[model samples]
Target chain A: MRIELALFASLEPYLPEGESASGRRTRMIDLPGGITVGEVVARLGLPDQPRVCFIDGRGVREDAVLTDGVRLAIFPPVAGG
Target chain B: MGSLLRVDMACLTVKKEPVPAGWAKYAGRALTDAIIFAEVPPKADPLGPANKLVLAPGLFGGTPAPNGGRLSIGAKSPLTGGIKESNVGGQFAHSAAKAGLAAIIIEGRPADPKALYALDIDAQGNGMLNRVDDLAGLGNYETAEKLHAMKGDDKLVTVTNGPAGEMLMKAAGIAVSDPHGYPNRFAGRGGLGAVMGSKGLKAITIPLGIESLPHADKEAFTAAVRKFANALKEHPVSGQGLPTYGTNVLANIINEAGGYPTRNFSEGRFEGVEKISGETMREITLERGGNVKHGCHTGCVIQCSRYYVHPDGSYWTKGSEYESVWALGADCGIDDMDGIAELDRKCGDLGLDTIEMGNVIAVYMESGKAEFGDVQGALAALEECAKGTETGRILGDGAEATGMAFGVERIPVVKHQAMPAYDPRPIQGIGVTYATSTQGADHTAGYSITANVLGVGGTVDPLKPLGQAELSKNLQIATAMLDSFGLCIFVAFPVLDIPAAFEAIYEMATAHTGDPWDADALMKLGRETIAFERLFNESAGFTAADDRLPAWMLTEKLPPHNSVFTVTDAELDSVHDFVAETAAEMGISKP
Candidate 1:
C-alpha cells in the first residue's frame, strides 16, 4: 500500500533529501497492509514511545492500522506558549 | 520567608513589613493574588493611583532550584480593565529573593507627573529611591546598557521599560535582563508596564552575588532539585528537542495541524511556514556562529531559549518563540526570518508585547496601510511606534484600539487584548481559554497546545469541542501552581509524561515549605489563586458576555478544516467553574 510519511521538527532528518512533490516535508513510502504505526516507526528507525503519530491529521494510537493513502505524521514532543 | 517592601510612589516613601502570618504560605501568584484582592479596589483605574503592581518570587525563589528564578507581575490591567498577572524569565526574581524580600508592591502615582525614580537594592539588601533622570525616556536596551555601566557590577539585575511605557501606552511591557544584560525577558501582557509608568517609576535593580538562597532543609531540597533536574534530562521534549531547536520548533507542527492562525486569524495556515520554521531558524543560527541552547535565566537546564545572531554573528534578539514567529511572520504575511528577528528585537527593546505588536501591525495591513509581507512597511510602522506619534500611540495600545482608529472591521481580539498565535476556530480548546482567561486572550493562561498538537498532557482533537473545557481547566489549574515556584512552565512537558517528574516537583515544593503536599493539594492551591482573580474580574464588571470570542470567529470558517469556534458559549463560561466545585469537593473554603 502507498502511504504518505510526514516527519516534523527533530524527526525531519529521517526523511530523504529535499521535500517530496507534495509541497510539504513529507515523502511517499510503501508499506505492507494493516501495518501498525509502531511497526512503521520501527521501520523508520524511530523510538517505540514518546513520539506522537497522526493519521490524516488526527492523533492515533501506535497500534492503529494504516490503510492505503494514509497520511502518517510523527513528531517529537514539543512545547511553547 | 522574607519581608514585603511597599514602595509608595505618591509620597516617595519605602516601608518594610513582615510577610503576614496569613500570607506566609503563599508566594508567587498566590501571594500576588491575595494582595491584589485585599488592597486593590475592583473599580480602580488600572493606571490610576488606586491600582498597584505586585512583583513576587515563587516558593523556591532565591534557592538553587532549577528554573526557580521567575517573577510574577500582577495588577488591574489598563488593557483588559480586569485583574492581570504576567510572568517572565530573568535573573531579577532570584536575586530579589536573595535580598530577603518576598514581594515588592508599588502603589500610588506621584504628585510630580514628570518624576521618574529608580529603586536600587544593594548586595546587603539596603533599599533606596533615587532620581535617575537620564533613564526617563530611553529604550530598554540603551537603558540596560547605561544602568549596567553605571552600576559596574556583574551581579546587578535590572527591570525597566522603554518610552512606550514612558508615554503610558497600554501595550507597554516591563523588560527584565537576561544573563547577557539584554532586556529581553518581558512580563509582556496586560499593559503592566504602563502601570509602572503611571506610578512614576523608571527601573528597579538588584545585586545578585549572594552565595546561596537560604533553604529550610538544604539537604532535602538539594536531593529533590537533583531528582527534578534528572527527570528533565531524561525527558525527550524538555531535554532533547527544546535544547536543540528552541520554541520555534512548533512552526511546522502547528502549521501541519492547520491551526497556525495566519494573517490576522483570517487563515488557519500559511504557505510561508518553512521560511520561518524552527528547523530553518536553527540552521541559520548555527551557520552564523550563534548559540541555540542558551537559557533565558541561569539554572535553566531545559534551555528552550536561544540568541539569534545577525549574519556577522552579532546578537540580534533572544527570543524567536513559536508565538513570536507566528505573530510577526505569518500573522503579518512576512516570511523573512531576518526581518522577523529585527522586528522582534525592536519590540523587545521598546518594551512592547510582540504578540500585541504583531496583531496591531496585521490589523494595519488589513486596513490597507501596507500590503501583506511588506517587511519595510512593517519596519516603518515600528518606527512610528517607537517615535510615539499620534497614530503610533493608537497602534501601541493593541489591536482593539488600532481597529477602532483605522475603521477596520473583523478585528480579532478578546477583552481588548490581541489573540496569540493559534486561531481559535480550529483550536477550540484554546478558544475557551482566550475567551475566559483573566489576563485576556493569553495562550500561557491555559496552554492547550500541549494536548492539541504536541500530545504532551493528553490528546484532544483541536477541531472538536468535546473534552476542550476540561482540558483547559485542568491545565490552567496546574499552570498556576507551577508559576508560583518560579519554575519555567517547560517542565510541564516532562511532568505530563512521567509520573516521577510530577512526584519530584511535589517533593521539592513540600521540602521547601516543610509542609505536606500531594496532587490534590496542588490543584486546590492553583484553584484558589484563579478564584481570587475571577472574583476580582467579576467585581470589576466582567460577566459571561465578556467571556466570549470575537463575533467574526463564530461566523467565519477557517480554511482547510472549515471549522469555527464550535465550543458553546456555555462551555466557555464553565471553563473556570471547576475551581470552585473542586474546592467544595475537597472540603476546602477559599476566603
Candidate 2:
C-alpha cells in the first residue's frame, strides 16, 4: 500500500530520510492488513507529540485505521491569528 | 488616577491631562475608540495633521488579569477610511500602567518631515519628549536595541516602525517589542503605523519601575482578578487548546470546515497546508531549541505565543501564529516555514501588517505580476515595500489598491480593509461582524465564535442568518465593553463558558469606579461606544452602502464548500437597526 504523508510548519525538518524538503513524504509500505493511524505513526518514527492529524480533508482520531492510497497529513499546534 | 499624556509633535510639546472621571470604565479598544470619535474629525486624512493616534492599555492591563496586557492602538485608517483599532501584547501595557498613565495620544504632525521624536515615560511619572535623529530609518529590531541600550532596561517597552512607516506606507504598523527583545508584537492593521509616521514620531519607549497600578479597591480587585484567572486556567479553550497550539490549531480546523482562504482565496484548501499547521510548528520548535508557546504580556497564563528559532538555535522570529502563517504562506501558496518566518520578520522590522501585505501580494500574483507559490517573488515584494519604490508604493497602499491595480475579481475586503483569514461565505456569522465592525473587516471586532456555539435564544443555527444579527450585535457590544477594560478578548473564551468569571471582572470594575452597575450596564456601554462610532462614520458620509462585502464575494460562489454569502442586503441593513435600538435602550439618541 502507498500513502502520501505531509508535515506542517516547524515540523518540516523532522521528516524521515528521502522525504521532500517541503515536508511531504510519499512512501510505499507492505502493511500487515489494516493498520491504525497510531501504529503507522509509530512505524514511521514520527514523534508522539501533541498534534492534529487528518485523513484527506477531514479530521480523524488517532485510532482510525489507514487504508491504501490514503492522504495523511500531520500538523503541529498553530501559532497563527 | 492614571494621567493622560498628550504629545503635540508640531511644537515638540508634551502635556499631562488628568484622567477623566469615570474613564476607567473603559480601558483598551473602548477608550481609544471613544477618544478618536470624540477628538478626531471623520473627514480628516488618516495620514494628515488633523488625525490623532491613541494607545491605551486594557482595563486589566497592568494587573494579574489573565491575558490582560493588551495595548490598543486606534486612529483614522489610511486603508479603511474608517475608525481602526489594532491590539497587540508586550511589556508596554504593564509599563504604561505602572507609570500611572492611562493612555498616550499623539496629535498634529511636525512642521519638518526630517525631524523625528521619541516619547520617554519614566517610572516616577516624569517623562521627556526628545528628538531621536539617530534612530531614523532603522528597523524595529535595531531601534528597540538602540532605545533599550540608551534607556537601561529595567523593564522597558519600545514601540517603533521600520522604513515602511518612515516612508508613510499605508501598510505600515507600529511594532512593540516583547520582553525578550523580539520585535514580534505589533498593532498591525489598518495602517496605524502610517498614522504614527504621519505624526512625525518615530517611537514611544516606556521604562518600567513604578510600584503598582492605582485601584479604587485593591482587595476587591485582587479577589476578582484571581477568580477570573482561575476560570481561565480551568476552561478548556483558554487553559488547554490555545496554550498548547497557539492560534495555529485553527489551521486544520478551518481547513476542515472549508473556510480557510487558500491561494489568494481562489480555493478553500491549500495542498501544502501540512507544512504550516500549528502542530508542525510546535514539533519543529521543540527540535530547534525553540519555545512552542510563550505568553504575550505580563501575568498571562495562556501562553499561545512561541519563539521559532533557526536550526542552529539563533532567533528566527517570535510568535509566528496562525494569521501570519495563513497570510504569508497558504494565501500566497508558499509552504516553506523558513520563508514565511523571514517575511514575518521583515514585516515586524518594517512595522507592516503581514495580513494586509500578504493579501496585497496575492492580488498582485493573481494579476500575473508575480507567480503563485513564488517564494522569492514574495520576498522581493516585501523588499519593494521597505524601499518605498513605485511598485512598493502600490503594494504598501494595501489590498483594495492592489485589487484595483490588478483587475482581480476575487478581492476579499469589507469596508475597504482586507478580510482576515476566514472566508465569510461559509462562516456567515463572522461575515456579519466583519461588515458591520467600525474597524472595517476585522476578525477581532466581534469574534462571534461564542455566539456561534451558544445560539441566540435558540432562534437559528449559529451558522445560519436567522439570529445572526442579534448575536453579532450582542458580541459587538460585549467586545466593545471588554476592549475598553483593556482586557484581552481571549479572556472572553473562558468567560463565555463560565458566566461567573465575567461577573467577577465586572465586580472589580464597579468596585473601582464606585459605580453601582451590573453586567447589563457594561453591555450598554459597549453598545454606546459602537453607536458613537457609527455616528462619527455617518457624519463622515458613510451609509448603508459603505457597509458591504466586496462585489466578488457577493457574486461568486466559493468552491468545495459551495457556499455564497446568502445574507441579503436587508439583513445587513438590519444590523444597523439593532444598534439604533440598543442605543435607545441605553438612553442615547443617534446624532
Candidate 3:
C-alpha cells in the first residue's frame, strides 16, 4: 500500500531522495498495510529523538496503525511562540 | 538601580528620584504596571499629558543570569483603551540596569506638537533631554543610526519610534537597539510608541555596560545560574529545537495539529506552510550565509534568534518569528517567504507591531481593498502608512480600526487588539487567555499552548473545553510572575518539565534580592499584580462584557475539527474572579 509522509524541522533530513529533491517536505512511500508509526519511523531511519506524530491532522501515539492514503506528519520537539 | 529617572517632556527637565520603598523588589512588567497604576490616571487619554510611559528592567537584568535582559514598556493603550505592558528583549535593559536606574518614566506631552526630543543617559545614570527636531519623521533604523553617529559610539543602545509613532498611529511600537545597534527588538503592542510620540520624544540612548550587576548571595546565585543554564541545555524543546530552527519550528507542528489560522481565520491550515516551515528557513539561511542560530542578548544559551539575509547575502531583517510569519504569510494568504520577510523588515523599520499590521492588512484584503496573496498590494498598503495617507492611517491604526473602516465583520480581536497566530476555536485554552488577559489578546500573557498544543507541562485535549479554564488560570498566574523576574518565557518549558529548573527560579530570586522567596510568595506576587491590573481596567471602563472572544468566534466553527469556542462566559469570568478573590485573601484593595 502507498502512504503519504511529511517530515518537518530537524526530521526533514530523513526524507527519501526523490522527496528531498522536490523540496516539498511531503513524500509518498510504499509500505506494508499494517505498519505502525514506530515501524514507519524505524524504516525511514529516523534518529532517536523526541518527536510528535499525527495522522491526517490528528495527533496519535506511535502504536497507532497506518493505512493507505493517510497523510502521516512527524515533527521534532517544538515549543510554542 | 536605586533611582527612578523621571523625564518631564513638557518642560524638558530630568530628575532622578529615589525608588519607592514598596516598589524596590518590582521589575519588568511588575514595575511598569505598578508605576502606571500609581502615576497614570486610569481614565487619562492615552496620548494626553496625563498618561506616562514607563520603561523597566527585570530583577535579574544586567546580571549573569542567562536571557535576563528583557525590558518592559507600559502605558495606557490608545488602541485597546486599557493598561498595557509590552515586553521586549534587547540591550537597553542590561545597559539601563547597570547604570543603577530602576525605571525611566516619561511624563507630560509637549506644549508644541511638532517638538521632538531625545533623552540621553550617561554612565552615571544622569539623564538629559536634548532637542531632536531633525529626527521627527525617520524610521527606527535611521533613528538608531543617527543617534549612534551623534554620540560617536556605535555600541550605544537606542530606543526609538518611527514615522508611525510620529503620526500617532495606534499600531506604533517602540524599538530597542539590538547588540548590533539596530532597532530590531521592539516592545511591539498596544500603541506605546504613540504615547512616546505624543510626548514629543523621538529616541533614548544609553551607554553599553557589559559587567554583571552584583548579587547579594553571589555563590548561590552563580550556582543557580549554572543549574538553570544546564537545564535549558538539557531540555529538548529549548536546547535542541530552538537553537537549531528558531521559533519558526512550531509552524509545521501547529499546522499538523489543525490550529494554524490561515487566510484571516477562515481555515485551519495553509497549503503553502511547507514552503515557509523552519526546515525551509534553515536551508535558505545556510545557503545564503546567514546566522541561523543567534542570541538576542549576551549570556543567552538558547540562541533562538536569527538574522535573515537577502539572496545575495545582504542584511534584511533580524527575525521572522512564528507569529510574524503567520500574520503575514498564512493570515494574509501570502505564502512567499521573501514577501513575508519584506513585511517583517518594513514593520521593524516603521516601528509598527507586525501582528497588528498583518491583521489589519488581512482585514483590508477581506474588504476588497487589496487582493489576498498579492504581496505587492500588501507592500503598497504598508508604504501608504509610511506616507501617512488617509487609507494608510486607517490601516496603520491597527486591526480593529481597519475593520471599522472597511466594514469587515470577522475581525479576530479581543479588547480591540489583534489575536496572535493561534486560532481559538480548536485550542480553547488560548482563547480563554485572549479573552481574560489584562493586556488584551496577548499570547505571552497566559500561553496555554504548552499544555493545549505542545504537551510541554502535560497534555490536554485541544478540541475540548474540559480542563481549559484551570490550565489557562495556572499558566496566566505563572506568566505574570515570570514576566516580573525579567526571565525569558522559553524558560517555562524546562521549568514545567524539570523540577530542578523550577526550583532554580526561586533560588535565583532569593539570592538576588536577599529575601525569602518560594513558590507561594511568587504566586502571591502574581496574584497581586493581576489584581492591580484588573482594578485599573475596571477604572478605565472595561466591564464583564469586554472579557470575551469576538462573538463570531463563539458562533462560527473552525475547520478541520470544526470546533467553536465552547468555553462558557461563566468559565471565562471565573478566571478573573479567582484572581480577585485571591487578591482579597492577600489583603489587596480594589479600584
Identify the leading candidate in terms of DockQ.
3
lDDT of 3 at B41: 84
TM values, all candidates: 0.96, 0.88, 0.97
Model 1 TM-score (2 dp):
0.96
- Candidate 2 docking band: incorrect
All candidates' chain B TM-scores are 0.97, 0.95, 0.98
Count of steric clashes across candidates, in order: 0, 31, 1
User: TM-score of model 2 relative to the true fold?
Assistant: 0.88
Q: Which tens-of-lDDT digit does each residue in B1-591 have in candidate 2?
A: 577888888877888898776565666777787788778988989898989999998776666666777898898888888888888888888788777778898999888889888888777555678889898889999898888888877357788877788888888889987877667798998898889888878888887544556667788878887888888787666677688878877776567546788888877778787788777777788888888777877778888888888889788887487888899988999888888988888888888898898898888899888988888999999888888788888889888888887798777887778888887776677788888887788888777644442221222343357766666667777878877777777777776667878898787776555666688877777877787778777867788888777777766777665777767778878776756676576454433
lDDT for model 2, on a 0 to 1 scale? 0.76
The predicted structure with the larger lDDT, 1 or 3, is 3
Candidate 2: where is the Cα deviation over 4 Å? A1-80, B21-24, B450-463, B581-591
Candidate with more favorable, higher lDDT: 2 or 3: 3
Interface RMSD score of candidate 1:
1.5
Off by over 4 Å in 3: A16-23, B585-587
For residues B1-591, write the lDDT of model 1, one tens digit per residue. 878999998888887888887676678888888888888998999889999999998887887787778899999999999988899998888888878888999999889898888888876566788888878779898888888888897656999978888888999999999987778899999899999999988899988656666556778888989999998998888888888888898887777778888888888889998889998999899999988887888888888888899999999998588888888899999999999999999988888898998999999999999888998988888889888899899999999999999988978889899999988888888988898888789988888888887888778888899999888888888888888777788888888888888887778887777788777777777887788788788889898998999988888988878888889988887888765675465343432
- Residue A15 displacement in candidate 2 (angstroms): 18
